[model samples]
Target chain A: MTDTEPRKESVSCPMDFILRMLMGPWTTYILYNLKTHGPQRFGELKRRVAGISAKMLTERLRTLEGAGLLRRDYEATIPPKVTYSLTKRGHELDGVLGSLAEVGARWEAEDAAARSQRAAESKSAELRAAE
Target chain B: MTDTEPRKESVSCPMDFILRMLMGPWTTYILYNLKTHGPQRFGELKRRVAGISAKMLTERLRTLEGAGLLRRDYEATIPPKVTYSLTKRGHELDGVLGSLAEVGARWEAEDAAARSQRAAESKSAELRAAE
Candidate 1:
């Protein structure tokens, strides 16, 4: 639907809905990890997404599952193994993720350049003051 | 830099940086509005981005400005008008935003279809119970 459409009965704006789906702290990271590394167990995901607490990881996983982005598979085994993989819908985000990564890389480069410029300016200022 | 690069002095990951820039409430909305409607005054933006508090709007604007995504113009007028517009970098996000909107539209359609199916199922269950 276009942005101008009347939404008197809609639950939420499409933009808002997608943003909500993606706004969770570790949501994108978790999705990225799953997409890149394929299906992984809970513990493996936890390790791959560094600095994420177990509580946060579990919550984000449930959110992603609820949103139909990923599937949880239960394997009958001696230890009861569980794996997570992106569903078809989840894999649909590949394009967006790739774009985001490219943008992120450009931003990183710009930031690095800015930082170096500022450092050089400061160094020159100090040298001029000493002279 | 590639993901495999070992950075001994990096400030943050590129993914983390872009995510941080986009994660703030009303950020993407404001950007989308500006991109679609062209430059807008502060008050106009505040109104267009519904539900955003003045304080929050100000914070997001500053963040966007700091990140070089948008530019703020101060026009010396009777009341000192300030306008915000997307910078070249901000405009670079058009492709990403377009993709997001498309994905969001698809998600909304899927959600609506699911709701209808559930409603139909519940109605059938009710009819069966009545019989």
Candidate 2:
């Protein structure tokens, strides 16, 4: 049986391959940006992702492209316009990213409600103490 | 607007939170194992996840539990039985994980076919060279 050690090649199962793809730093973020905002130039992606270094972002983008998860279109202009977008294979991740967004949104709301409830309880306790 | 820089507190959106959760090393594997195999003991989980240290596995489990994504059950026995499983909230990730698996399986199949084609091409080239 192939245990779950992450191997770059000869991957035994699809789950392992996908996990490795998703776990790379800023990988999903890049994918999410492309999926949500559509194709973007290199600079736009950098600004949108926030805090990702130029070198790091470039590396991530290249890696994704190598994995066939994204496409890089280069226009030879004065500065060489480069736009990145998801490939058909890459777009298959739409369902997964969307579901994650749904869950994340729900959890954020629940956490907010819990925080408000805690604040209310603390305020009531302060009032009781004063009384 | 909240850009995609990871913040531990006051997360601005569901997608960011979900991205953070999924990007953690061995996080998805743990979740996938639990989702696929149902509940498992700590030892079983460690073995199944492959290459995860006991300390790291414990930490991942604790974090997931704290986030209300999984549950830990303890049995009072001589050996102190402990089992881990996804919570109702954790189970919500079913769609995301399932979709990822689907994509992975398809990619894996395509990759295998490509590899075989390349090998066949190489063999034919060698035959031509010999002739």
Q: What share of the true interface contacts does candidate 2 keep?
A: 0.56
Model 2 spans > 4 angstroms off:
A1-13, B1-13
Clashing pairs in 1: none
lDDT (10s digit) by residue, model 2, range A1-131: 38854352442345656766766667777887888799999999999887779999999999899889999999999989999999998888777777777878888889999999999999999999999
| Candidate 1: chain B TM-score against the reference chain B | 0.84
lDDT of 2 by residue, B63-82 (tens): 89988999999999989999
Q: What C-alpha lDDT do the candidate models reach, one value each?
A: 0.83, 0.82
RMSD of each: 5.8, 4.2
Question: Worst 10-residue stretch by lDDT in candidate 2 chain A?
Answer: A4-13
DockQ by candidate, in order:
0.39, 0.51
Encode model 1's per-residue lDDT on B46-78: one tens digit a residue.
Answer: 887776889999999999999889999998999
